[model samples]
Target: TDLAAWAHQDVPFDRLVEALNPERSASRHPLFQVMLTVGQSLGSGPELGHLTTEFVVPELRIAKFDLTFGFEEHRTEDGGAAGFDICVEYATDLYDA
Candidate 1:
């Protein structure tokens, strides 16, 4: 696999998008599938603390996720990192799977 497509340095976003392999996009990414499971767990926001869940993705990878959902609009130092927290659901024909 050419590592350039996944490298996020000074490369422009459009070129990176154009160079992505369909097979890799389809199921090569375990993190992506993990996020999908997390999104399914969290339907809406206005909650706090960490959410834990598990799932099995390709390559027989078992993912244990503990993601934080914050009701606060801004991130405090105590919160580690904070910003506009929202649950955004989107889709694209980027992956064949």
Candidate 2:
């Protein structure tokens, strides 16, 4: 997975956050700041509805989330923007005991 590879290959976390914006959203959350300083979301999404904005991986766990840009699975007639759906999904060795 790209994310795993990035960690293995030493890609900066900041770049990862920059590329982590939502594919389809009315507005974007300030995710880059959160993921950098703290490793989780503060859940400051709009007051009305929940937003699926951040992706979290703990420091002890390594993840390879198969996400890519420019691979939109659908398009709207109104010319709104969307992005890659995970052709492959996230995988980690951790399991519930």
Candidate 3:
């Protein structure tokens, strides 16, 4: 299945609204679905750290996630040329923003 589609259905908006807010009886928010998709992709295990590869998946209750892939320059103590550094930012943002 497509990555985006997987994320979209990973969690239902109605479920999230009911779980997070039992008091509200309104319809689900569009952001809820979007957030769940991004959250599931970024929070997936064995994709980042090497040590935690053996562990099972954990429960992440998030509205959404943001992932960024990039590289940076690094230098050795002796001022020698170093290889590029990889960096990632995993975050869950509230829909209010």
Estimated TM-score for each candidate: 0.22, 0.18, 0.21
Which of the numbered candidates is closest to the native, going by highest lDDT? Answer: 3
After aligning candidate 3 to the native by TM-score, how far in Å is the CA of 65 from where it should be? 7.4
Give the candidates in order of lDDT, highest first: 3, 1, 2
Q: By TM-score, how accurate is candidate 2?
A: 0.18
Write down the lDDT of every candidate, Cα atoms only. Answer: 0.41, 0.38, 0.47
**RMSD, one per candidate, in order:** 14.3, 19.6, 15.4
Task: Locate the minimum summed-lDDT window of 10 residues in model 3.
Answer: 33-42
Model 1 earns a TM-score of 0.22
Task: Report clashes for each candidate as comma-separated counts.
Answer: 1, 0, 2
Q: Per-residue lDDT of 4-85 in model 2, one digit per residue for the tens?
A: 7766666576675567654544232344211211122232344545655553435533323322112224344554544333
Q: What overall lDDT, based on C-alpha atoms, would model 2 receive against the true structure? A: 0.38
Per-residue accuracy of model 3 over 1-97 as CA lDDT, tens digit each: 6887677676787786566665432344434322211221122346565565544545454322354444555566676656665644345452333
Give the C-alpha miss distance for residue 87 in model 3, angstroms. Answer: 1.4
Candidate 1 Cα outliers beyond 4 Å, as residue runs: 1-7, 21-84, 90-97
